[model samples]
Every structure is written in structure tokens, then in C-alpha cells.
Target: MRWALVGLVTFVLFFPVLAAFFILLPFDRDRKHIHPLISFWAKAVLTVCPLIKVRLEGAEHLKQNGTYVLVANHQSIGDIIAILHLSHSFKFVAKEDLFWIPCLGWALWLAGYIPLVRGDRMSGKRAVDQASGYLKRGVSVLLFPEGTRSPSGEIQAFKVGAFKLAAEVGVPIVPIVIHGTRDFLPKGSRLLARRVQVTVKVGIPQQLAAKNNGSVESFSDQIREEMIQSLKSIRSQFKTGELVSV
Candidate 1:
């Protein structure tokens, strides 16, 4: 009930601001403050949804404005809000389908997001190349290499695509272990009445070896293991059950 109301209000508030962004795009392409502004708005949305007090650790380890490939375990939609609230130069390489969100979609495109379309080889290649080039231009990328939200919030095997892009772009990977969000809001759950405390553990950045054919695979494994070790209990919570989507 509470979350539903908040979501409705959020949609109402965000749409206008997004509309204004587009309305002014032709007149002025200046969006230097856009990232922080959108982040501030997202924080308000979190406040309204009344997310449990978030406990963030190792945040000091994160570079305030540094560019790196941020790799996090998939949990829930709330993860996106948490990320926007925490990260400074946060940009995402997300599903191509996300481009369909009306106002927000336009904002993301103007903000330089790299869209990933799965199973379409040509389209995927185009997105991958865009990601690689974006890194070269100093844009940081966020990826949920698990491909989809873990229905049970149990960390799944990461696909190799994100890692390959990181290695190709010569950027370090920042592995994040997120906990408790799945319980608060799982995939396909409409009610958001529970207050579930969340924790985000930002691990150290692991730089991949350049020019090594096998190093990318090794680096991906290391990141996966580090996340699993850090999120042991959270993974157990998923044992309760999962609502698998067909």
C-alpha cells in the first residue's frame, strides 16, 4: 500500500521533470548538473518509498568521480535507486528494453547509456562497441553481469559479456555485494509495505591484465568468488522460495 502510493506519486513527479528536460534539449544541450539532479530526485523517491536505513561500507574505497566498470550482484529494482543515491558519476549499461521508458528513456540516451540487447548478435555487438568506446571517453559503466535479477536473490553465474567489455576497455572492475533488497522488493511484487534494511559492500577494484587472452576469464571468476564470499547469508535468504517468471 505505502509503496504503491509512493510509486504513483513518484511517477507523477518524475514525468514532468523529464518532460522539461526534453523540452529544453533543443534550446540547450547543457546537462552537466543533470546526473546529480536526477540522483537527488531518486533520493526523494527512496525517501518516499521509505527504504530502510541503508548501511554502506567501503564507500571510501570508491573513487568519487573515477571511471571503472561497476559489477554488482543482481537483487531487485530497489538496487537501482540505491545505486543512484550512492554513486557520483553513475551511468549504466542496461537492457535495450529500458529504452522504452518514455521520459526516462530519452534522458538515459542523452546521458549516454549503452543499451544491451540479448540474443541479437549484431545489436549486442553494436552495444558492446559503444560500451568500449564510452569507457575510453571517461564514462563509467554499471553492469549486473548476472544478466537478470536473481529470482531467489541468489547470486547466479555471471555471463562473460560485461567482463569482456571491461577487459577490452582496459578498465578496472569494482565488485559490489548487495544484501536485503530482494526481501524488500522482489521481481514482480507490487506491494512495497515492508521496511527491509539494506547493505551495500563495495569491494576493492580489481584491474584486469591487458593483452592477455586468458586473464579476462580469470578476473571474472575472482570477482564472482569475492561477491559470493561477501554475501553468504543474503544468498541463504533466497532459500525461502522464488517466484520464477516464465
Candidate 2:
């Protein structure tokens, strides 16, 4: 019943907003207009679906006008919804197939998010190049460094693309960690849990060293490890019931 209600609400709100997005596209260069609309849509979805509770931490770390190569660990589809709560303007590097979905995909295209075809070498390079272009133009780009959601909800091996792009464009890498979303909407299932608490922690933005001899692969590893540690800390607080919602 809850899932059905959520779906109805999503469709009802999505169509009209998508129409508005289409009309704005010709004048919406840099996607400055589209992203905020998407953010509001996400917030409204979360509001109507009371079963999911999202708690955000370290929001103070984000600067209003700052540009970043935002990186996060993916757990489930709900991760994107949780991220939308951040209310920050950024373009996503998403899988190619997602761009084919009806309303959602159209919105992604209108928002100017980059698409990546899995396991295709040229596609990988193109995604990096497009993302780099956005970063160069002072727009933040968000990427899931693991490339896909971890089936076991564990931190998977990091891909070098995000780190490489950040290194090349001289942008700060902001690490974000999300937990409890998998419980709300696990992989390969559409049934929503009655109640679940999701937490997102935004780490301080770190810039690559100007003279570092380490490869981008190594830097990716370092960031992944930091995210692992942050996830562990969030889990501990969850168990202790000490988390204060933001």
C-alpha cells in the first residue's frame, strides 16, 4: 500500500515537472535552473514517503558556491533520493540505461547528466571527458567511485575515473557516505520497508597534492578507505542510538 502510494505521488508530480523542464531547456544552460527543480522534486517525494527517514551530517562542510567532484558509495536506488536531500547543485555520472527510462531518464538528459556504458572502454573515456568538462566549467560532478552498488552493502573497490578527473581538473574531492538505504529499498526488489532510517555523512573536501607522485589509482584507494572508516563510524552511532538528525 505504501509503495503504491509513493509511486502514484511520484508519477503525479513528475510529469508536470518534466514538462516544465522541457520548456526551460533552451534557456537552461549549465543546468542551473533544472537541478534545483529536480532537488525540489526529490524533497517532495521523500516527504510523501514517510517510511524513509534521512538524517544528514557534516552539511556544514559544503560551501554554497564551491565546486566539487562529489564521490559516494552506492547501496541501493534510494541512495540517489537520499543524495537529493543535500540540496546542492551537481550533475550525475549515471549508467547509460538509466537515461532510457521515460520520465526519469528524460529529466536526466534535460539536466545534462553524463551517461556511461558499462565495460566499454570508449564510453568510460567519454564519461570522464564529459565530467571533466563540467568540472572545468565550475559545475560540480557527482560520481559513484565503485561504479555500481555493492550487492553486500560493503565498500567495493574504487574506480580510478573520479580521482583521475579531479586530479586533472584541480577540483576538491568531497567524500560522502550513506547508510541504511539498502534496508529501505534493497536491490532487486520494489517493496518498501515500513520504516527505515538513512544517514548521509559528508566529509571535508580534500584536494589532491600538487606534487604527489602517487597514481590516480592509489588516490582512489585512499579515498575509499576513508569512506569505509566513515561508514563504520555511522554504524556505531546507529547502534548506540546516538545520532542526532540534521
Candidate 3:
């Protein structure tokens, strides 16, 4: 019943707002105006659901005036909804298949989010290039460096695309750690569980020395380790009910 109500509310709100975005696309060239609405949609989902409580920490660490390549640990599709708990603005670098979905896909394209075509070298490069363009224009881009959700809700292997993009654009990489989302709505299922608490930890922007002196591979490893540690700390506190911001 909870899942059904949330789904129905999302469908009702998402389609109209998506259409509104389509209408604004031609005039909103830089996509600055449309992205906030996307954020609002994310916030609305969390608001209406009421089944999950979301806590955000270290959002103050995000630079309000600078562009960033934001990377997060992906555990489930519920991570997307949990992201709204953060107040920062970012464009998502999503899979190409997601761009083919009806209303959601159309809205993504209209809002100027970049799409990665997995397994196609040329397509992948083009997508990264486009994301770099957005970064250069001061738009923060979000990517899940694990590339996909972890079946066990553990941090997965990090990919180098996000790090490379940040290095190429001379921007900082902001690592976001998400917790408890998989437990809220695990992968391969749609049921929404009640009274679940999700926490998002935003790490300070990592200005990679690798951008000037080292390899993206090394930078990726460093940031991945930071996120892994952050997740562990958050999980430990959550288990003890002491994960509140100080």
C-alpha cells in the first residue's frame, strides 16, 4: 500500500513537470533553470513517500560557487531518491537506456543530463566530453563510479570516468556516501518499507594533485578509499543511533 501510493503520486506529479520541462528546453539552453525543478521532483518524492527518513551530513562541505564531479556509492535505485536529501545542485550522468524511458527519459534529455552508452567506446567518450562541457560551464555532474548498484550493498569497484572528467576540467571531486537505501528498497524489488532511515554523507571536495601530477587511476583509488571509509563510519554510527550531525 505504501509503495502503491508513492508510485501513484510520482506518476501524477512527474508527467506534468516533465512536460513543463520539455516546453522550457528550447529556451533554457544552459539548462540552469531546469535542473532545480529536477531537484524539486526528487525532494517531492521523498516528501510524499514518508516511509523513509533521510538525513544529510557535510552538505556544507560542497562549494556553493564551484563546479564539481560528484561521485557516490550506488546500492539500489532508491539511492536516487535518497540523493534529494542533499541541497546541492548537480546534473546526473546516467545510462543511455534510461534516456529511452518515456517521461523520465524525455525529462532527462530536456534537462541536459549526459547519457553514457555502455560498451560503445565512441559513445562513451562523447558522453564524457559532453559532461566535461557542463563542468566547464560550472554545472556540477553526479556519477556513480561503482558503475552499477552493489548486490550486497557494499562499495563496489570504482571506475575512472568521473575522476578523469574532474581532472580534465580542473574541478574538485566530491565524494558522497549513501547508506541504508538498499535496505529501504533493495534491488530486484519494488516494495517500499516504512520507518526506514537513509543517510547521505557528503565528503569535502578532493582537489586531486593527480590532476596536475599523477594518473586518474591513482586518484580514483584514493577517492574510492575515502568513500569506503566514510560509508563505514556512517554505518557504525547508524547502528548505534548516533549518526546525527554535530
Task: Give the whole-model CA lDDT for all candidates, comma-separated.
Answer: 0.72, 0.84, 0.80
Q: Roughly what TM-score does model 3 have, to 2 decimal places?
A: 0.87
lDDT (C-alpha) at residue 150 in model 2: 86
TM-score of 2: 0.90
- In model 2, the runs with Cα more than 4 Å from the true position are 1-5, 210-214, 244-246
Clashes of each: 0, 0, 0
Per-residue accuracy of model 2 over 97-116 as CA lDDT, tens digit each: 88897667777887788899
Which pairs of residues collide in model 2? none
- Full ranking by lDDT: 2, 3, 1
Model 1: lDDT of residue 234? 46
lDDT of 1 by residue, 1-246 (tens): 877977776677676657656766676433324566566666666677665546577877777767788899888876766766665565677778766776456656665566877777887788777767667877777889898889987789988777888777878888988887787788878666367767777888878755344677777887898899889854454455431111
Show model 1 residue runs off by greater than 4 Å.
1-32, 51-53, 101-110, 209-214, 233-246
Cα lDDT of model 3 by residue, 31-113, tens digit? 77776676677677677676676888889997666789999999877787678556666788887877897556776777777
Ranking by TM-score: 2, 3, 1
Best-matching candidate per lDDT: 2
Candidate 3: minimum summed lDDT over ten consecutive residues — where?
Answer: 237-246
TM-score per candidate: 0.79, 0.90, 0.87
